[model samples]
Structure formats: C-alpha cells, structure tokens
Target: MKVVFHPDFYQVYTSDPAAAKGRMEAVVKVIDPFAGFVTAEMADHNDVAAVHTEAHIDEVRRQRLYPVAMLAAGGAVQAAQIGLAEPCFALVRPPGHHASADASWGFCYFNNMAVAIASLKNRGRIDSAYVLDIDLHYGDGTVNILGDKSYVTVHNVDAMRRDAYLREVADAMDRCEADIIGISAGFDNHMEDWGGVLSTGDYFEIGKMAAGAARRNSGGCFAVLEGGYNHDVLGQNVLALIQGMAA
Candidate 1:
C-alpha cells in the first residue's frame, strides 16, 4: 500500500498524547518496510476553509498548529486520492476526528477525514462515500461536518465487546454501497490501550471488512490515523490494519 506520510509529522506540537514524541515514528517503524512512503503536501487554503471557519483556522495558527494540522489534513487528501485506485493508509497525527467545523477538542485541530472526503467530493472524484470510523470515540467532528451531506454516510463503531464490535463493523461493511470507503482508524480501543476493548488483530479484521466492502462495490478505500495512544503497541495495531486492507 502507498502510505501517505511526511518526516515533519514526527514533530510534536502539543502536550497531548496524540502529539507526543515518537508517535509517528512508532507507526512508521512498523509500516516502512512493507509500504511505500509518499511525502505529504499542505491542504489548500480554500479546502481548509471549506470545512472550517476562519476563526478555527486562525486559532490553529495562533497556537502554531496550523502547519502540522494542515499537513495531516493534506495527507488525508493524498490518501483518499491514492485510494481511488488502490487502498492507502495515511500515517498522520493531531488526530482529527474530534475537530468540528468551528470548534475542536480531544487533541484535534482540523477534521482530516472530513477534509479528505470533502475534497474528494469537491473534485467530482466520488458521487457517494461511506465512512467507517473505528475510533474508540465517536467521530462527531466527521459526522458534524458531513452527516447532512446527501452523498455521504458516516458510521462509528461503538460496541463495547470485542465480538460485538467486529460484528458491528461487518454489518456496516455488508450494508454499504458507495464510490469510496474511509476508515477513521484508531488504536486507543486496543486491549492494552485506554479503551481496553479491542485487540490488535481486531483492527486487521475491521480493515478486512472495509476492504471486502470496497471490493463488493467496486469502490475505493483508505484510512487515516486517529485516536491511538499506547506507543508500545500502536505500530502493530496500525500495521495490522494496513496488511488487512492491502490483502
């Protein structure tokens, strides 16, 4: 798979776990050997403004997070574009699922998933999209930005049990019909992580389910990094998803 990434992603911009040192490096170490790396670009100003208020953009700039956040968002666009032809994974940070259009919380600045999906739509690359946010938390920001849109549907897996969660993903994948599928991949739900509900292999299963859906519908599929902490096992979890999707 083509992994959209940049070395600058290794820079830490905040005290949050998502911005901690070595977080990007951790995932890179595991994926680098098996994946091709592509340098990320900055998102267009208009693209950023499309889903975020000017105030939100200025606030990110005020905090010196604008560049990195935009870069991550750009990586998401790159991933989505790459996905149009084949599955891709974006290893980025300042996880963006919690960021709404005008306000952001939970260590996010810009909603990367929203930015990617919207950019794809704006370019007339897809008629409809299916987003499976497998984050430990609900992708309220993604939903807030895209829910009302006629061409996109968002589903966040919320089951507490491992089996139930896998079933939920399977069910969603089975029912989806779209031009593309996006996974807001998060690892915090891993058994060793904060959520402590899912195991590492569960991510692989989720990725496989998304890949199966894309195959069934003849659509594209991609993923972007989201709320995964636990640096010790984060790499394995991410690699699992990439392998499954690429499979």
Candidate 2:
C-alpha cells in the first residue's frame, strides 16, 4: 500500500485533538516500516473551490488554516487517484467529515473526501464512487456534498454494537457497486479511543471487506485520516486497517 503523507502534517495547526502533537507521528511510526509513502501536495485552488464555497474557503484562510487544510485535501486526492491502481491511505488531517459546504465543525475545515471524489469526477477519472465512513461520528459533511449525487453512495455506519457494526459493513460491501471505494478511516471508535466500540482487529475486518468489495467490483479503494485521539493505540489501529486493505 502507498500512503499519502507530508511532514507538515506533523505541525499542530490547532488546539483540536485531531491536530494535537504526536497524533500523526504515532500513526506514522507504526506504518513506516510496513508501507511505501507518497508525498502530499496542497490541493489546487480550483479543486478546493469545486466542492467548497468561496466564502467557506475565505473563512478557512482567515483562520490561517488554508495551507494545511488544502494540503490535507490534496493528500486525499492523491490517495484517491493512487487507489485507482491499488489501495492507499492519506495520513493527513484535519478530519473533514463534519465539514459541510459552507460550514465546518468537529475540527474540520474543507471536506477532504468530497473534494477528492469530486476532483476525480471532474477529471473524468471515475464514473461512480462509494464512500464508507467508519468514523465515530456521522460524516454529515461528506453526505452534504456527495450524498445527493446520483453517482455516489456515502455510507456512514451507524451501528454501535460490535456484531451489528461488522454485519453492517459486510452488508454494505456485499451491496456495493462502483468504480471506486473510499474509506473515511477514523479510529476514535476503537476500544481505547473516544467512541470505545470497536477493536483494532475490527478495523482490519472493515478494511478487508472494503478491499474485497473494490476487487469484486473490479475497481479501486483508498482511505484518509480522521478522528482517533488515543495516541497509545491509534497507530496500531491504523496499521490494522492498512494491512487489511493491502490484503
């Protein structure tokens, strides 16, 4: 697996836990030996503008988050594109699932998943997409932008129990039919993280199911960074997902 990342992602851009110090480092240290890396670039202004309102972009700039936010979005796009041939993961932040078209919260600025999928669509790289957001919270921002699109299906698993959650993911993957699949990977749901519902091995299952779905569809799959605050276990959880995807 090729992971899209940048050293700048190590910078603590905000007081938010998503951007907290050592958050990126924890994940990187674990995955570095297991996977190849691809440098992330800042998203083109036009690409960012494609999914975000000018007002929203301006607001991010006003907060001095434009650079890092755009970089994260770019990393997402890179991961998505690379996924066309093989599985990839964007180890960048701030998490964007809570960000909407014109408003953002949950430590997000631009909707990185939306921007990347839209960029692929705009470039005629893919005819359809499936987004599986395994975040602890709902991916309202991703839905707000890509939900209504006839070519996309954004599934934010709402199941809480371990069995129910895995079943839901399995069912979704069984039904998935698209040119590409993207995972809004968030480890906050880990037993040691904020949500405390899933285990590290559960993440591997999710990733395997997603990769299997993509393979069944004869398409591609990828993931991007999201919420996972427990530094102690965050790296292991992320690596589990990556290993599964690579499987």
Candidate 3:
C-alpha cells in the first residue's frame, strides 16, 4: 500500500503526545521496509481555506503551526486521491480529528479529513463519502464542518467493549452507500494504549471490513493516522491495519 507521509512529520510539532518525539519514528521503523512512501506536500491555501476560517489559518501561522498543519492536510489529500485507485494510508499527523472549521484542540490544527473529502467533492470525483473515525475520542471536528454538507456521513465509533466496537464498525460498513470510504485509523484504543479497549488484531479486522465495504460499493478506501500513543506497539498496530487494507 502507498503511504502518504513527509519526513517533516517527524518534527515535534507540539507538546501534545500526538506530536511527541519518536512517535512517527516508531511507526516508520516498522513500515519503512515494506510500505511504499509518497512524499506529502503542503495543502493549497485555497483548499485549507475551503474548510477553515481565515482567522483560524492565521492563528495557526501565529503559532508557527501553519506549515506542518498544511502538510498533514496535504498528506490527507494525497491519500484520498490515491485511495480513489487503491488503498493507501496518510501517516502524517498533528492528528486533525479534533479540529473544527473555526477552532481546534486536542493536538489538532485543521480538519484534515474534512479538507480531503471536501476537495474530492469539489473536484467532482466523489458525490458522497463515508468517514469512520475509530479514535478513542470523537472526531467532532470532522462532523462540525461536514455534517451538514449533505455529501458526507461521519461515524465515530465509541463502543466500550472490544467486540462491540468491531460490531459497530461492521454494522456501519454494511450500511454504507457512498462513493468513497475513509478511516480515521487511531490505535489509542489498543490494549497497551490509552483506551485499552481493543487488541492489535482488531485494527486489522477494521481495515479489512473497510476494504470490503469499499469494494462492495465499488468505491475507494483510505486511512489517516489519528491518536495512537503507545510508541512500543503503535507501529505494529498501524502495520496490521495497512496489511489488512492491502490484503
């Protein structure tokens, strides 16, 4: 699978764990040997503006976060575009699930999913999209911007049990009817991670289900990194998902 990434993602963009040192390196160490890498570019300012406010964009610049944030968004766009043809993963960060159109928090600066999906819609590549956010936390940012757009349906899975979560994903995938499916792949729910509700194998199942859904709908599928924080096992978890998607 092609992974959209940039070496700059290795820079500690913030004090948040999502941008902590070695976080990207840990995942990179494991996937580098097998994963095909695609260099990420900075998102066009117009694309960023399409999903964010001018004030929010300026605020990011004031905090010296504009450059990297745009790169992450750009990586998402690249991943989404690649997904139209094949499965891919955007392994870039400053995880954007928590960001909104006008505000941001939880280690996010811009809503990358919103930007990427909106761009695809704007270019007439997809008429509708399904977003599956499996992060430990809700992806309110994505919903805040795209919920009312009519072209997107966002599902943030928060089942408390491992089996329940998987079932929730299965149910959603089974019901999906869209031109594309995107996974907000987060590993924080892993047994060794923050949520401690899911196992590493679960990610693979989620990925496989997503791939199946896309195939069934004759659509495309892709993923972007979110809130996995356990460096020791983060790489393995991500790899499992990628392997399943590629399979």
Candidate 4:
C-alpha cells in the first residue's frame, strides 16, 4: 500500500496522547517494511475552508496548529485520491474525528476525513461515499460536517463486545453501497489500548470487510490514522489492517 506520511508528522504538536512522542514512530517502524511512502502535503486554504469556518481556521492559526493540521488534512485527501486506484493508508497525527466546523476538541484542529471526502465530492470524483469509522469514539466532527449531506453516509462502530463489534462492521459493509469507502482507522479500541475491546485480528477482519465491500462496489477504499495510545502494539495493529486491506 502507498502510505501517505511526512517526517514532520513525528513532531509532538500538542500535549494530547495523540501527539505524544513515538506515536507515529511506532506505526512507521513496523509498516515501513511493508508499505511505500508518499509525502504528505498541506491542504489548500479553500479545501480547509470548505468544511471549517474562517473563525475556526483563524483559531487554529492562533494556536500555531494550522500547518500541521493542514498537513494532516491534505494527507487524507492524498490518501483518498490515491485510493481511487488502490487502497492506501495515511499515517497522520492530531486525529480529526473530534473536530467540527467551528469548534474542535480531543486534540483535533481540522476534520481530516470530512475535508478529504468533501474534496472528492467537490471534484465530482464520487457520486456517493461511505465512511466506516472504527475508532473508539464516535466521529462527531465528521458527523457534524457531513451527516446531512445526501451523498455521504458515516457509520461509527459502537458495539461493546468483540463479537458484536465485528458483526456490526460486517453488517455495515454488507449494506454499504457507494463509489468510495473511507475508514477512520483508529487503533485505540485494541485490547492493549485505552478502549480495551478489540484484538489485532479484529482490525484485520474489519479492514478485509471494508476492502471486500469496496471491491464489490467497484469503488475505492482508504484509511487515515485517528487514535491508538499503546505504542507497544499500535504498529502491529496498523500493519494488520494494512495487510488485510491489501489482501
């Protein structure tokens, strides 16, 4: 897979766990041998503005988070665009599922998933899209920005039991019909992570189901980093999903 990433992503931009040292390194260390790297770019001002208010954009700039935020958002766009041809993963920081149009929390400044999906829609590259957020938390920001859009459907897995969770993902994939599928891939739900629910193999199954759905629809699929705190197992979890998607 062509993983969209940048060395600058290694910078600890905030005090949040998402920005802690070694978070990005953990994933890179393991995936480096299995994936090709693609340099991440900064998002266009218009692209950022498409889903965020100017005030919100200014606020990010005021906090000195504008550059990295834009980079992460742009990386998502790059991953989504590349996904049109093949599956791709974006290793980015400062997770964006918590960011809304005019407000943000949970270490997020810009909603990267929304920005990327909107960019694809704006370009008429996709008629409809499905967002399968496997993160531990709900993607309220993604929902806030895109929930009402007729062309987009965002589903955040919320089952508590491992069996139920995997079933939920399988069910969602079975029902999804779209031109592209995006996974708001977050490893925090891993048994070793904060959420302490899913296993590494579960992530692989989720990724495989997503890829199978996209293939069935003759569409594209991609993923972007969101949350996962355990550096010890984060890399292996990421690699599992990547391997499943590629499979």
Candidate 5:
C-alpha cells in the first residue's frame, strides 16, 4: 500500500506544541522507516475551500494557527483521491472529526474524512461511504455532516464496553452498503492510550472487525490516524491495524 506523509505536517498545531510534536514524531518514525512508500509534500491549499466553508477557512487563516486540522482533513481528501486511482494511507495529524459544520472544536478545524468523502461525492466517484470512527471521542462532526445524507454511513464507537461496541460496529457493517470504507483509526480508544478505557487488544479487535468489513464489501479502504498519545501502545496498535487489513 502507498502511504502519504509530509515532514511539515508536524508544524500545523492548535494545541500544545510539545504534544503535537510528540505525535508527529511517532508517525514519522513508523511511516518513514518503511521503504517504497511514496512521500508527497502537501503543496496545495486550494481544496480547503472545497470541504470547508469560507468563514471557517477565514478563521483558521486569520488566527495564524498551524492549520494542522485543515491539513489533516486535506490530507485525507488527497488520500481518498489516490484511493480512487489506487489504495493509499494518509498519515497526517491534528486529528479532525470533532469540528462541526458551523464551528471548530476539539482540536479540529475541518473534518478531514468528511472533506475527503465530500470531495469524492462531488466528483461522482463515490456513491456511498462507510465511516468507522474508533477514536475514544465520538465523531460528532462526522455525524453532523452525515446525519441527513444517505450517501454516508457513520459508525462511531466511543465507549468503555468492548463487546457491545463491537456488536454495534458489526451491525452497522452488515447493514450499510458502501463503495468505500474510511477508518478514522485512533489509538486513543486503547486502554493504555491517554485517557482511554479499552485495552490494546480491544483496539486490535476493532481494527480486525473493520478490516473484515472492508474485505467483505470488496471496496477500497483508507485509514487515517486520528489520536493516540501513548507512543508504545499507539505503535503496537497501528501495526496490528495494518496486519488486520492484510488479513
């Protein structure tokens, strides 16, 4: 699989510089170490307007912020575009999905996965998308954007119970008909992850289940790393996720 990454991705941050740097460093270590993966510098900011409203885009620019959230969202859009041509992974940071339509919150300026899905829909390339968000936090932004849209099916898991959450995820996978699967894979859902209540095993199980769904659908699957503060657990879970995808 082709993995897309940019070194400057670490520079875009709206929160503590230290935390953002830590996450970026971890992502780089994992992706850059692997050979044959294509690394592309994100040079275009034009698509920001395609997924985000003018007011929200203006706020991000005026604040002189890192635009990490926007970039993350944009990166997902780029990856999805690549997915149309070939499978790809978007390794970007400043996790989005919390930022709502009318406002930005929870360290997200624009919903990256949402933006990517929207772009695909607008281009008539995708008729349906299944978004599986495994972050410890609910993907409120994605839900808000997809609530009335029949083309998007959102399965958000943000609870402590593993079996129940997995059951919910399985049900959604069984019922939803989608041409592509977008996984908002966040290691924060793991117990060892910062402020997480589920174990690393549970996180792996979730990934496996999601991958199984993707395989069953025979549709392209793209996973974007969202949030996970613990380096050790994050690394392990990410590897497990890729393995699950391969399974």
Candidate 6:
C-alpha cells in the first residue's frame, strides 16, 4: 500500500490557521512511524467540469479556493488516480465531501473525491466506483454529484449506528460491481472526536470492517483522511486501520 501526502496541505486554510496546522502536524506525526510506506508528492489537480457546473466552479474559485483550494483538490485527485493505478491512501485536509455541485459549504471548497472519480471515468480507467463514506457527516456533495449516475454507488455510514452501518457496508460490497473503492475516512466519528458518537474501539472496528469488505470485493481501495479532531483517538485509530488493512 502506498500513502500519498502533501506537507503543504497543512497551510491551505487561512480561516483556522492554528487548527489547520495542528491537525496537519498531528496526522504527520502519527503516520511518520509507517516509514517507507509513504509515496512522493504528486499533483492532484484535474479539470473536472463534468462534476460541477461552470458557475459553481467560478464561485468556488472566486470565494473559497482562490489559490490554495486548487492545489488541495489537485492532491485529492492525484491520490484517487494512484488508487486506480493501485491501492493507495491519501492523507489530506480541509476535507471535501460537503461541497455541493452549485456551492461550497462546510469549509469544503472543492469536491476532491468527486473530481478524482470524474477523472478516472473520463480516462476510461474506471467503469464504475463504490464510494464508502465513513465521515460522521453525510457525504452530501458526493451523493448529489453522482446521484443520477448509475456507474457511481455511495454507501454513507452514520456514526450513530455501528452494527447496522457495517451490515449495510457488507451488503453493498457484496452486491456492487464497482471496479474501485474510495473511502472518505473521517476521524471525527470517534467517541472523543469533535461531535463524534462512536468509541475508540468502535472506530477501529469500523475501519477494519470496511477494509474487510473492500478486500472481499477484489477491488482497489483508497482512503483519504477527512475530519478527526480528537488527537489521541485519531492517531490510535489510524494506526489500527493501517494494520487492519494490511491484514
């Protein structure tokens, strides 16, 4: 498994300067122990006109992204590309599953995963994809963008329920014929996490269960760090997730 990350992602947001830096630093420190598993920085930029309306793109560019959001979105697309090429992980920030087709909200300037999927589909590398969104919040952006497209299937897990969510995941994995899997892994779902409802153990189990489903499907898997505010839980859960995926 190859982990794709960009150190500059820490500095992308000027809104919460300190929080952004802290979150980036914490994720880096936690992942540093898994040396040699990380890959060199690659451009994540892709012109995804299909996913967003031109007006929406212009609005996001004028307001949120300006100069940096583009880079962040680019990194996300690059991570997805790597996943399509082979199994990989994208450690990025300013999590983007909330931005809708017409506007950007919830601190998400661009729908990174959507762009990546669009890129892959356009290149003919991905005939279909299953998006497993584990964020505490619903992946409204992804759902809305790919809602009508049968080639894209979204499985959103609400942090409030564990068994039910996992069962749904299992069902989807068993039924779907997607060529690749994209996980919107959010640590905020962890018990001590900001607005989280699941315990540390539950969080680790969630990752393990999801990874297991991905493995069973014989499809490539790629996960991107979304939102996980509890530092301790985030670190521990991420390490556990890596181990689980390896298993």
Per-candidate TM vs. native? 0.98, 0.99, 0.99, 0.99, 0.86, 0.85
Candidate 4 local lDDT, 152-218, one digit each (tens): 9999999988999999999999999999999999999999898899999988888899999999999
Task: Point out the higher-scoring one by lDDT: 4 or 5.
Answer: 4
lDDT value for model 2: 0.95
Q: What lDDT score goes with residue 53 in model 5?
A: 71
lDDT of 3 at 201: 89
Residue-pair clashes per candidate? 0, 0, 0, 0, 2, 5
Given candidate 2, what's the lDDT at residue 29?
Answer: 90
Q: List the residue pairs that clash in candidate 5.
A: 73-112, 191-198
Show the lowest summed lDDT stretch of 10 residues, model 6. Answer: 35-44
| Clash-forming residue pairs, model 1 | none
Candidate 6 residue-wise lDDT, 1-247, digit = tens: 5666666676736665223557766666876777334433433333556677778878866765545556556666776776655556677666678877777676676677787777788888778888888777888988888767889888787636656665666676567567778877776766677654656665456555555656666666667767777665577766665555545
Root-mean-square deviation per candidate: 0.8, 0.6, 0.7, 0.5, 2.7, 2.8
| Decoy 3 TM-score against native | 0.99
- Please state the error at residue 78 of candidate 4 in Å: 0.1
User: Where does candidate 2 have its weakest 10-residue lDDT segment?
Assistant: 92-101
Per-residue lDDT value at 171 in model 3:
99
Model 2's C-alpha root-mean-square deviation from the true structure amounts to: 0.6
